[model samples]
Target: MAKYSEKASEKVEESMHETKEGKLKSGSGKKVTSKKQAIAIGLSEARKEGAKVPKKKD
Candidate 1:
């Protein structure tokens, strides 16, 4: 598995928790229900925050 920075992991964990609680939303204002989507969102946020995360796959 790829190593994630502590901040990145924390963001992902928080996203997962929000997803499980049905409180995660998408950019289009839709509710997020998929695990993958939540993780993606978390990574996106981490990127925005300048966290040490890998580049997005092509």
Candidate 2:
């Protein structure tokens, strides 16, 4: 299992949160319709923020 810091976890949570309309769209203009995509987006953002973590390989 991989480990994530509190800030990383929070960033994931905030990114996955849906609006009242329940739409999941990433900032990159991609439609994130699944939890996996949401988490991926969050982790990607966290990585860009310089959070210490491993990057996922596609």
Candidate 3:
């Protein structure tokens, strides 16, 4: 497994919580229903904030 920064992990955790609460949404404005999607969203946010995260896969 790849190592994630503490901030990145926190963002992911928050996204997971939002997903469970049915409050997570996609860029297209659709509700997030998949765990993987939620994690991806969190990672994307972390990247935007300049957290120490790996580059997105092609």
What TM-scores do the predictions have? 0.94, 0.74, 0.97
Name the regions of candidate 2 deviating beyond 4 angstroms: 19-23
lDDT by residue for model 2 (1-58), tens: 7888777888788777852235668778766777887888778878888886677877
Tens digit of per-residue lDDT, candidate 1, span 1-58: 7888999999999999999999999999999999999999999999899999999999
As for candidate 3, its clashing pairs are none
Q: After superposition, how far is residue 19 of candidate 1 from its true place, in Å?
A: 0.5
Order the candidates by lDDT, highest first — what do you get?
3, 1, 2
Ranking by TM-score: 3, 1, 2
Model 3 / residue 42 / CA error / Å? 0.3
Candidate 1: give its CA RMSD in angstroms.
0.7
Model 3: CA > 4 A from native: none
Candidate 2 clashing pairs?
A: none
Clash number for model 1? 0
